[model samples]
Target: MKLSVWTYEGPPHVGAMRVATAMNGLHYVLHAPQGDTYADLLFTMIERRNHRPPVTYTTFQARDLGSDTAKLFRDACQAAYERFKPQAMIVGASCTAELIQDDPGGLGAALGLPIPVIPLELPSYQRKENFGADETFLQIVRTLAKPTDRSARVSCNLIGPTALGFRHRDDITEITALLNDMGVEVNVTAPYGATPADITRLGAAHFNVLMYPETGESACRWMERTLDQPYTRTIPIGVGATKDFVEEVAALTGCIPRLDTDRLRLPWYSASVDSTYLTGKRVFIFGDGTHVATATRIAREEMGFEVVGIGCFNREMARPIRALAKDIGVEALISDDYLEVEGRISNLAPELILGTQMERHIGKRLGIPCAVISAPVHVQDFPARYSPQMGVEGANVIFDTWVHPLVMGLEEHLLHMFREDPEFNDAAGPSHHAHGAKQVSDAPDPIGAQIIWLDEAERELRKVPFFVRGKARRNTEAFAEARGDSQISVETLYEAKAHYAR
Candidate 1:
């Protein structure tokens, strides 16, 4: 509802469109004004989808406000059904359309269409995109899924993936491959490359795999409760997570997963001497709940990075994020304001940032390397190459994606060793310096020169790597000030480091 240059999520209707677009033979009838059609560009331009989203917008202008907007909505629904011949249809209104008070769901129901019409009553002012998608997907499953006493097979349904998700296509492929390797058949993948028939037959699966927690959790919980079916909560985004996911699936469906550990290169890569520099590298992570939580674990446990800060724009999932942060001994940042995220990033001054496109921009401005791990992404994040954020292959992709921006351990060591050499520190500066250093250096000081540093402490601070020296200096000064010290000394710096280490 708050107007800004940037937002973490789109409107509720847009989430409905994502669900409709991801499924086959399913159409979305959005009661919206002309400008609202811009959601189509997200799929076409960013996802590079060949076909336009199966969405029919009323596109009523201000002039039509005086007219019968209800009739306009009915006509739009009828036209969408006739043209698309969809097996199922979802009806909803955009934020502006919601103010007009036109009952889109009621109108669609009155249309008397041959196909099933799922009415979406999403409160645009109260909810956002992920919530809408979750509701829409849940409604579709609830309406289509029928209770049956059919015996379960060695199969599962992958739930919660939709259009515009972060690398969802590749993630689905990777997960499908892994399931195949485990000799488990995928019965259906709802709201993403699934059909109306697939949704109706969801109960045939032995269990459900919750891929993205944001959109799939509700549906999985409903299915589990109503149908007495179990689900795996493990998100296979990292090496450890993938292994855990496989084990969880095995436990749920009693299908022994034959995982090829050799295919998962992240474990070996992280243990290699070349990746030694990655160890203890400070990282700031902010994104949706699933990616932020998974990335925090991967960065800390697998890639050997210290999660200096972690957060998510998805406030509904804040509790889990806060718990994860507490376990890591860091406070969780739960906010929608990009400025707050930017402020935290500046304060933390992490070496690498794993988040959305907005974080990428923040990292760029801060001369920090970043990898896109969540949605509200940019076109660059949707690479032509297959890069998934799930399964064994996904762990490998994450390792490369996050590590590519950082200097190798050997390279970093060489730079530090020859830093004082004239050839190494030429007038043009070292080759290892970030290209955006000028902009980053021009950033306003996060904390002013309030705390004085003694000459000995300043000299000791310079011994730290330049990339982390600023954070080290700030931490030491803050520690001294907290203990009522007027000035920071070499002993204070060591004390701060030791305190932080514990």
Candidate 2:
């Protein structure tokens, strides 16, 4: 694994925990060290779950290496089964426990538990959280899912709603509501509030709705190949996508596509005169693949924003991101490094940023407005309010969530216009002192003392907004320095802008 202070996704076992925790009548026995159990807090604290996740960790210490570490895993599995009385159990090892090679799965299998015992062979060194979740979900479905004659009535299974997702619980509600409105039945939703029996009845559904591609697409595809159950791949995150999703589902189910335009507020909201200020607003997006791709489309199609930069930290799902970026005539930023994302954000100087909590922090540092659109999220993202990122209601939520930060555009423009007046500055003192003062104190001079600039060039730089003048000046100076010029002229400044524009 690469060294990082923070990561977009945790190790494979954390993913397994998500699957185990999201389901009913399922328990996970994790063969792990003491520190590995910290993943529990991700659910209990951040998600504000009242009940603990159904997981039992061995918590084996280094001293246990002298004894039978395998026995500790077995005992944990036995205790978990007895205490939870789960219909099924999953056995796996954490990153550190994998080094011991105790084969927790084999140990659990030997006990002859009454319930199904699924063994997870996740390579923490090679795979990440999303991969683990996918593998675990696939394993559970493979073991429990039973084939049956396709029902004449239209029904589907919603796959990929899991614990710690970005508003997954609400997404299920919204999607369920939409399907009900269209007279379609939801047979089951896997890895999220589904029992082992629900998994067994998966083949009863006529189709599957693949929500998050990273987590459930593999299992959905497998079902399609093995069970002859078709699935819809559209992710209904925005108005256009939601409309298309309804149409696609209708076509598959032979049901009439009906949408209450009033319910989907994004189209109306975007078309309103109040949103005119949002037109051509430069935006930067970076996150996990599903949200990144969906948000990019919404930004460009519905929000009238110019998507200057787009990316994802998930290397496994980078292909679609790269394809989307290529279609938009820009290179996709595919890397796990937050620094690379931060640097791109710095260079782009977008007016708005939509990304994870990490990007929110970077945008805050750079004095740009940001919205959290994806996971690796903070507690603030998991609000008590219903905020799904799917269906028509989800489109409304996205509109409000993304637009609120930049809604004061007119007021900000007026403030900038009147900033030269002493009265205006005095009136804005408190607000400026709280925000602008820090920026002024922290920022170095735009034209550094080391680099000389001609009067015309300095005058041109002054025309730029104070917030961006430093970056503009730095870029110009770097261009002059690269050309071996000691002093910058207005011609050089324009040349630099043109060069950078290319």
Candidate 3:
């Protein structure tokens, strides 16, 4: 594999960990080397999971390569099953271990384990994390899910919503509430809080709600094809999309779509006079395909922002992302390279950025405001507050998350305009903070004689706000100097304004 300091997605095994981690009564036995154990910290630290992931690593060292590594994997699998007593287990090889070609699947199958043993044949060199999650979930469903009697009431399985997803937990809560309000029952939420038994009960649902397409699409397609259960396509992230999702569910379950938008303040706040300035603010978006597509619609339609550029790192989503980008009059950036994404962002110089945690760093380095809209996020993105990115409550969260960066930037600009003030100097700290203040020097007096302004010119300059008078004065003097005038007049001041306006 090509060496890079950072990657947008990890090897396929990490994706397998995501699926295994999201579920209950399911264990993943990974035939890996010693260093491969680092995936544990990702869940415990980044996702802030209270417990370690449900995984057992063979953790064979360099010395063990000369020995029977296959025996080590078998022992680990047996130990995992005995220790965890899971209802189901999956076995796979990490990227480095794949080179040994121990055949983890075949080796796992040889073991006469009482529980269901599903072997995963994931090509580490070819596929990425999302694909691994999708494949793993699909395998589990294929092995466990069976056709059963449908529920008396209309119900659906909430497919997707795995661990490490950005706000998946909160999104599930919001969507579940929305479905309950619509008189629909949720059969089972899979992959996150599901068990092997839940997979079997999936056939009981009348339909499926596919929340995340990247990790759940394959599994949903299988259920739809095999179990005769249809699934919803519309993801309820924004006001418009949520409405469409409601209507889609209504059609599926014969429940009337609740068009009550009275709880939504995004439309009203967006159209308010105070937010008019936010209109036409250019934005660059990059994330997973699903989030990028949904964020584009919200950015352009809901928030009145101009989408200058849009793309995703997930190649599986390239076609739809490209189609959406074409509709918006821009090329879809479908590369995993952050450097290329940085170059594109630099060329576009958007006023705002809505993307993943990687793009958050890119924005900070470029001094652009950003909001996290997708996965691969840091621990900070997993806040203690109830922040959902779907349904009515989710719409409110989106409004705050997207708008705060711009408003905070404006606040910083205002503070900088008054930086020379004794109370507002850099050393003085923010007025809202409780830090101690320090004295800061103002600009020293001019060394040489400067252009003088007439009484009318000075009065006209005062018409500009005090905070920006220095800029007006400087521009007026420069204009007078360029014209070879000895003093600045009212005409020169107005002329400078016109020159700058152009």
Candidate 4:
């Protein structure tokens, strides 16, 4: 409602669209105005789907409002059913249409189409995207899911992979392999590759694997009460969590967990000598609650990074994220305002950021390296190759995603540190062009005083890895200036490192 250049989540109806588009043989008819059709771009352009989303907009214009807009909605609905002939249809009003009180659900029912017509009473003003997706999925399940006999072998409905989600396609692939290894069959992966028929057979599954609580929790809870099916709580995104999820599923399915580690490399890689530079590196995390919590564990436990700050934009997830932040000895930020998030990142000045696309922008502006861990992402996040954020392969993808930025950041820092050195300065040009490049002179220092480094100290500094030499030089200079010493020696450098370690 408060018009902004960017938003973490779209209007609730957009969420409804996500659910409708994610499934097969399901369509959404939205009673919206002309401009409301723009939601299609989110799917077509960003997600790069081969086909347009399964949505129909009753694009009522300003002129149509004066003359019976309800009739327009009815006409649109009849046309959508005739054209798509979906097995099920979800009808709702966009924020603009909600003002006119067209009552899409009631109108949709009156038409009496052949297939089941599920009505969505989405409060566009009161709720946002994730809530809308949850409510829509829940309504569909209530209307379609039938009581049935459970499968002979233990099976689960993989709940909550939706359209426009961050890496849902690949995550499913990685997770399915993990489940198969434990001898559990996936009954169906819903709202992503499912149909109305799949929804009816949901009760056939022994249990449910609730992948994303934001969109699937409500429906899973309802099934728990109505169908006597329980769902898994842990999401398998990291090494530890994946292990926990494997054990949890094993208990539910009575299958012995394979507990395989042959494909996992993060555990040993992070502990290796090459990764020592990652230890205690300051990091800030912000995204949806699921990813924020997952990234926090990976950063602190697996990667050995210090979590300088942590937060999420989904206010519904505030309580748990707050609890997480408390356990981590930091204040939890539960807000949707990107400006406020940017300001906090500025204050924290973390060396690295793990967050959404919005925070990716913030990190760039602040000169901090970032890796996207959640949604509200752009087209680039949807890679052409496999890049999941779950299971062992996901852990591998994450390791590459998070560490590359930090390593490149170190390279940039080293570049700045040696800017005055003729051999490495801007004037040096490319290695291939070095013969034709012009030589450059060092600029005079604008600051009156400078701490000189002794020959022995400079040699000792050179012995440090080039990637970290800049940080060492700066720390030594700071230590010298703090003690009123005009020069830095080997002793000063060692003492400064020891002081910082303490």
Candidate 5:
């Protein structure tokens, strides 16, 4: 039971690449295929940028497989240095490159390169996009974290910012602002414009704020041992968590906690007024372990929803989810297979689903409303709005995202009519209307959504000459048929290499 071949927030390497690039003065040389250059889309498409990604690729092909691949990797690295002249460089690989081990870090070490080179191993085989970003940031900090000015005691580091949950630029702004308000000068904020020197100052920070849990553990521990700066385990995901995060930092550095009480008030007000309007909302959750666990707590404790089922594809973070399932008295459906996840959807019989984008297809087929609360996202998730599911602001966002789609006034209107029209209720045999996927009476129902990128690509290729188009179409159909809406399992995705090798 494993999940494989799923869409992520961006190219798997993009998250880590963002961190390495954002640093004021840093560069990253990624060992990957030439096609992996698709990472630039994140900045252009999602972040809406004009610059290129700060990465270099070895880009070995089948022809070069037997030719000194390691040397090819080193040459790429040297070329990157000659072009970028980066003071610090990160040596890393992506999913495909990981399959073929070319140790760039060792080469850099032996070469005695003038600039600092940090090794990064975020193999997509065993982890998701978030893990890569988080781990990449941690490795950078670990390689450079050192105390500065023994008497300079203003110590704190901000970690986690790849633009999934609370990884938004606004979040970085809010957090850095809050930390400054607390009198704790942040030594470095991982992946949020942190350079090699800034990373080295990580040890100077007395603590690390793990904004997201998927990554940053390594640097936190390293700083703990070297700088004796204890990192806080509190992640500011929800309203209470954000306040607590602030209070904890205040307590540590002896600064007053700032509270935008207005942010807290609305959720409480909304819960009091409309939660009952939306109570017993049968729901199911699935995705990564961090989201599954915390959202379970929020749904049960705060939102008053009956969480019918829950699971995740990330085993590293699954124990907590398993415990949550037991607490909610539901058998946790833990599998990565699309078919298995789809099958599990049956037992839950939920009105709504909060999972990855794959679940969107399940919800669409099953006629259940779905909100993508976790990763494996498509381009759709990258809205122009600052949407982070971490912190008090995030709680409000969740409330809106989950509630608005389900509480269609039209459904209530239809139900009211069903209750009033006694004849209509009595003659309810087969209806012309689509069952679960309710649409407004006066509006035309929209057609199924095509995966925008794929559909557009197909259309573009079809415009080519007949011979080229024919072959392209055939290959496209073949690849689609091979994948064929195949469900993935947590194990299959997390353990891709292990399974592939075995």
Candidate 6:
């Protein structure tokens, strides 16, 4: 079966808006139609954020598409400014508006507001959620960077720190800690906790460290040309790269990243004995280039897994991932087409899959255990813990999630072992339950395999240490509890209402 990732047909800008809305101070004044504002719920509910992401819809429905969008843009800018009193303003359009090309940047420039105004032009024709984040981040920084005759501040910029890209809260905490250790006070970090003045003060940063690669290249180039401040290209993902990343930042900004010797000691599931099970496993990977690249290093060097199939949907990363693919002595699966991605996954036949949510389905169809390694994660994948696929802690998290699928839970493994042992199973009679999911010609599927539910994991986790158990319990319970009742299954829009009513 072929799945098309073509624009407007799949998912819309809701995920992008979720990232924009989750940020604390910034305002997202999107020049989209009325319904596009639905992205607010993805943040408020999914991420459990307190406030509605400050958003303004131009309300330009199909009726308003071509005629007088210019006036609507102006009104949106003015009204959004008046209402939010935002530190900086992000003027953006969704997939629908991108088709019409109402230049919000030009509008932002013409408005002449006291605050920094950023114009975002993300077209539906080409980009997806990651692209939106990257383009929005770079363009916002490019537009807001102020040039002064004064010397550069000791301050530094933290790029690509969006909410969803690395939604794990500990990722931000570790980054801030590393920056403080380097002694270079962070001037700005986007979408997490920066104000309008902080966005404007972006130029004041002596050097910019890119946390996510998608946002790095353009921002780095613009900063270098405009402000004469260079950016560190390397992103810190694992223990070694993080150390190297900090050291390189130290070399540039004279602030050294404190090498946490305890990075390996982090309370990580995969970084411990779990990763031992993953050693030498032929694995497949696909996602944004930054994550894929960082994960490749962690899998190979840190976790001892072999990257068999590699690919990414990012057009910007073609050159790098293509090269990385060749270096590993394998053909990379880089393309926008999901058919081609499915083809690559078929050919690789990996033991485990680290890929997008789409690939999760692909792996399921192919009878392989898979974990989401990139953008477009579902509600199920959030896993409440501070799990980011970056830094030593992240490496550990990756290690565990990937290996967990391959290694059966201890209880399941014990059951299997006991059933095989004559002494343990000879005394018991076997009971059978009807297999009731979709069945086909007796072909192997995920039907009989263990799911490793949160409840089961939690009951077992109580046997673990106290310090680690609380965080694990909180994250696990949040995910399991929030998942609501398992018995309630609604298949479609019509059934959803019936399920809710019942």
Best-performing candidate as measured by TM-score: 2
- Summarize candidate 3's per-residue lDDT along 294-397 as a digit string, tens digits: 99999999999999999999898999999999999998999989889988986676778899888887776655678999988999999888999999999999
Output the worst ten-in-a-row residue range by lDDT, candidate 1: 436-445
Total clashing pairs for each candidate? 0, 0, 0, 0, 16, 4
Better of 3 and 4 by TM-score: 4
lDDT of each: 0.84, 0.86, 0.87, 0.86, 0.65, 0.64
Candidate with best lDDT: 3
Error of 1 at 283 (Å): 1.5
**Which sections of candidate 6 miss by over 4 Å?**
1-19, 22-25, 63-70, 99-116, 147-155, 254-257, 266-276, 409-502
Sort by TM-score, best first. Answer: 2, 1, 4, 3, 5, 6
TM-scores of the models, in the order given: 0.88, 0.89, 0.87, 0.87, 0.75, 0.73
Candidate 1, residues 1-502, lDDT tens digits: the string is: 4668889998788888889889999988889899889976899998888899999999999999999999999999999888989999999899989998888888889989999999999988888899999999999999899765544558888998999999998999999999998888888898899998888888888789999888889999999998777998889899889889988988877778678888888888788997777889888999999999999889888989989999999888999999999999998999989999998988777888899999887776666677788999988878889889898788888888888777542355467567778656522322444552443322324452567778897767656655665667667767777898877878888999999889
Once superposed on the true structure, which residue ranges of model 5 sit more than 4 Å away at CA?
A: 1-15, 21-24, 98-100, 122-128, 150-155, 163-167, 177-185, 409-502
lDDT of candidate 6 over 1-502, digit per residue (tens): 2445532122324434644664656777777877666765666565656676777888887777657998998998898888878877777777667767778778877999877777676666566666676666666666667875433546677776656554545667767676776576777776456665566667767877777666446667787888888888777777668778878887886654566656664335445775566667778898878778877877777667788978888777889999998999888877767677777776556666788777776665554567777775666666666776666666566656766666542333345346657654412321111123121111222321222334444335434332122333333333433455232211222243333456
When 1 and 5 are scored with TM-score, the better candidate is 1
Who is ahead in TM-score, 4 or 5? 4
Per-residue lDDT tens digits of candidate 5, residues 1-502?
A: 1445654334346667767656656777777777787767756665555567777778778888777888888888888888888878888777777777777778766666788888876757656665677677777776776666532766677876654343356567666665766677776677666667666656656677876566566666776787788777776666667778888887876778876656554367555755576677778898877677777777776777888899987555667778878878998876666678887875445667888888877766655667887766666776767765766667777777777656653354355346436555412321322344422221111221221224345345434332122333333433433455232233222233243345
lDDT of 4 by residue, 45-105 (tens): 9999988989899898899878999999899999999999899999999999999998898
Summed over model 6, clashes come to 4
Q: In angstroms, give how far residue 336 of model 6 lies from its true place.
A: 3.2
